[model samples]
Target: MSVKPASSNRPLSPFMIGPYYRAQLTSMLSITHRLTGLALAFGTVFLAAWVTAAAAGPDAFAVFADLANSIVGKLLLVAYTWAMLYHLCNGIRHLFWDTGRGFEMKTAYASGYAVIGASVVLTAAVWAFALLV
Candidate 1:
């Protein structure tokens, strides 16, 4: 039985998408940076609302703070902290590259891996501190 290739000479636009996994670390990191940026944006809105409620009155503020200190809130805080720190550190790495430095292939990969490692380490540390305090 003769069958043509699955894609069959069709153009590969995102509009005609199929399973594709270009699992390169750099691409993964770039995508992750954008996702984390979105998380941070949502977190910021949550925080702003908390602050606004707090300024409204003691009762309103306590309610907001209580919810924020709940188990779910604590879990979210952990994730949010990591997202914030990771994005910040990665932004700094990019800023360095923007200054016409660290463009070497080895340096690029080294910095990318370093960003990943540091993000994990910092996330763990922040969660540990949250647990202790």
Candidate 2:
């Protein structure tokens, strides 16, 4: 008796889709949450450097102060601020989820959007207050 070989069927053309193809709000928020967490780490490093410089005396503090006043530095500061705010809001969302809340699809989406909106608003308000003070 002869045994038949197994058949092999493969697609003629296999195209790769984008990583975020048709991603839902929750998925997008999940990615953003991780990214912001990383960003906050870098931001903390910068903060630590600033504090260390301040402690090192006038000359060292002057260097950091000058950089902080530069245009690029200002933009980075803003971006870091937003990252912090976004991470904070998303963290609260996750906390709620941990408590067995916002598991529903609609509620999850709503909270995702709300987190984004609240982050923007909080960042803007804090910046405005900083500028005005």
Local distance difference test, each candidate? 0.86, 0.87
lDDT measured at residue 84 in model 2 versus the true structure, 0 to 100: 90
- Measured on C-alpha atoms, candidate 2 has an lDDT of 0.87
Least well predicted 10-residue stretch by lDDT in candidate 1: 13-22
lDDT of 2 at 100: 94
Error of 2 at 101 (Å): 1.1
Clashing pairs for model 2 are none
In model 2, how large is the Cα lDDT of residue 107?
A: 94
Query: What TM-score should be assigned to candidate 1?
Result: 0.79
Each prediction's TM-score against the native? 0.79, 0.84
After superposition, the stretches of candidate 2 with alpha carbons farther than 4 Å from their true spots are 1-21
| TM-score between model 2 and native | 0.84
